[model samples]
Target chain A: MKNATGIWALLLGLTLAEVALAYPSLAPAVFLLVLLALSVGKSALIIAFFMHLRFASRALTLALFPILIALILLLLGFLPDAQRVMHAA
Target chain B: MTRNETTWEGGGSPFAIGAKPLGMWLFVVSDALTFSTMLMVYTYSRLANPHWPAPFAFSPSIVQATVMTFVLLSSSLTMVWAVDAMKRDDRRKTVQYLSATMFLGIVFIVIHMREWVHLINDEHITLTANPWNQPLFGATFFGLTGLHMAHVTIGVVYLGIVALGTRMGKFKTDHVETSGLYWHFVDLVWMFIFPMVYLMSVKR
Candidate 1:
């Protein structure tokens, strides 16, 4: 991330957006969705640019891929709970 | 198999991804898993109990946390600048950037400690109980957030060592980049923690 300062500026904007949208006035579902989305985007930016993953070799990328997948899949696993499943009688 | 024919005998990069950085990457992934599992547990418990209270407020805690987040994010930027300086082999500039990063890191820890005091003393929250009468909430809150705070505290000290080593002409580009990787990983963890711990906990 040669443009280190610029990346910081973008991160600050996203963070402020998260704070702004997290207010009680906003609907809970929308607030959670937007904030989580923004956080994921911020993580991507940091990993690719600041962490130099973009310049990393294919082998390194492959090495890191499964860890990232596990995190995402953990969240996806919660989808059924968020869906409010019916209990078996 | 003689020493003369051994290409590895000479000083060369050990791994395809560069040995030091590859090791750092492994550490980052393992650390990520640690925090991720803690956070996922928090989420699961929070979801399991619909009545989980939103104890974090905007008055003192949230605002302070927001500032702390900014501090950490800014520190990451400074760390990157330090790496850039190292790339140019400018020891002076590298030291300056590293010092700035360390300063911001200390500032973050101070602000976080203050907030923790507020939460514990003023809010009467602890690992066991709080004003919310939801002890489980406090447990998860302190457990996860406390773990993250420990990381920031350790990072400050870690960067301090790197800064001193760099000033003494001990560290080079690879070492600086390795430290940068660690710092950025801590920031990345907070990027997720901030929203989950503070933003998501706010009442709506």
Candidate 2:
């Protein structure tokens, strides 16, 4: 119970930081990086604690880890193609 | 009270996580991939057109989306508390927490709907091309967020049924725990969507 409350506080702090970064004056590129990084931070906390992965065994963690890696790789693979199209036109 | 017996006690679950929870975890992973694909396409569309219109700025959608995020996050907290209450065999508190979670789920859906109405009616956005000529803008925005909203809607109904079952003394900790898994997964997805969709679109 105490831990859940602590996690909620941490999540809220991350959220506030994100809101601050969203201000129109902030550079879009910097905002994008910080916002996404904070998002990953927030997601890690939720997946680790809220989803009970923190206490889960290696078998469970190992099962889901590869999918995450593959999806990220897929994103990288798709990026340059989109950028190339943008550059051409 | 007799605890539920599992066939996996012998061999299937070497780690002893049990079949039901394991099944739930697998479902969550697959669902995560489904959203990831949609988000990937959204990223593709956003980058494909650097002039991709960000209609969220100068509108109420950002504020509304932030509120929705909080409502969903609060729902997630209630969901975990529901699981905790059930683990303690406190039926009343479990029902209370589940009900609160359901209410928050409904609140989230309502807020999102209002934002959509504002975008469509006042902002003149649609699933087709908006006045901005960024056709994919409305398409991806509504597509991804709509998918997540559907999940939230189903989650509300799912939690409602479970909450009712708990009120009638028809469920146990197992039910609440699984629901907690689903609810948290939904919240986790929104944590990504909130920044990816709303904040990133805010004009600079």
Candidate 3:
């Protein structure tokens, strides 16, 4: 696909942005947020374009999305408890 | 084109035999759950000891890990090329690209071995040693990264098998596409691990 090269360029740009965020002056939470955003963006691009999941049937995409959603929910749900435990320790 | 027939035929009906790409996605999802658990543990450990000093202060050898990351990521591109070649029915190009991917995968493993030796021998960050004055740092670092390296080693073996299969004309075009899916998933995991494990704790 002609668009594949452009997607890679976008990935490279995101990586560059991640490197820039490593600067100490950036707020730590903000840096983490930016990194997470870029990571999700890169994953989306790879899944949608390179994997051709974008062109696939809606049922297939729906099947995969639920698993990812559950994983995210699990991660977020445990974060507070983890933080509390860490602070207590 | 027969609209009356419910089944579209290639190697078999897509639903009957199941698409190889779909099967690979199922595997990837299972693998993702494994990595997610590891990452959750990593986060919990880090949270437990936020003030703990990192083991290595400014080791330039860590850059070797970065280089390895780049090599692994580039291999994904080769894998995509291999899949494209297969789609075009260019077996020769497919084999070449697969070989290139296998070679890069081996290079990554070799570099990883060197980095492991440096971490263990030079830095003395063994399982029993607390190099960073934190007990869990060495344990969790090695555990998470070691598990990832194990996955990479498994991927290399799989790629080698696929390379041989391609040479023998055992892999149908769809099979090559499926293998490519797994290869790209491996790359995807490393993309996350590279930043989280290697880059996250880097001192400014």
Tell me candidate 1's fraction of native contacts, as a decimal between 0 and 1: 0.48
B35-98 per-residue lDDT for model 2 (tens digits)? 8878778776776677877778635777788778888888888888999999899999999999
Q: Model 1: DockQ against the native?
A: 0.48
lDDT minimum window of 10 residues, candidate 2 chain B: B1-10
Q: Is model 2 an incorrect, acceptable, medium or high docking prediction? A: medium
lDDT of 3 at A10: 71
- Candidate ranking (lDDT, best to worst): 2, 1, 3
DockQ-based ranking, best first?
2, 1, 3
Per-residue accuracy of model 1 over B90-131 as CA lDDT, tens digit each? 999999999998899889888988988888898788889877
DockQ of 3: 0.41
- Candidate 3: tens digits of C-alpha lDDT, residues B1-204: 554554444433543325677788888888888877777666556545666544433355446755675686678778878888888878888989888988898898888788778778876777656556776767777887787778778877887788778778888777887777777777677666655555556655
DockQ-better candidate, 1 vs 3: 1
DockQ of all candidates, in order? 0.48, 0.60, 0.41
lDDT leader? 2
What TM-score does each of the candidates earn?
A: 0.89, 0.92, 0.86
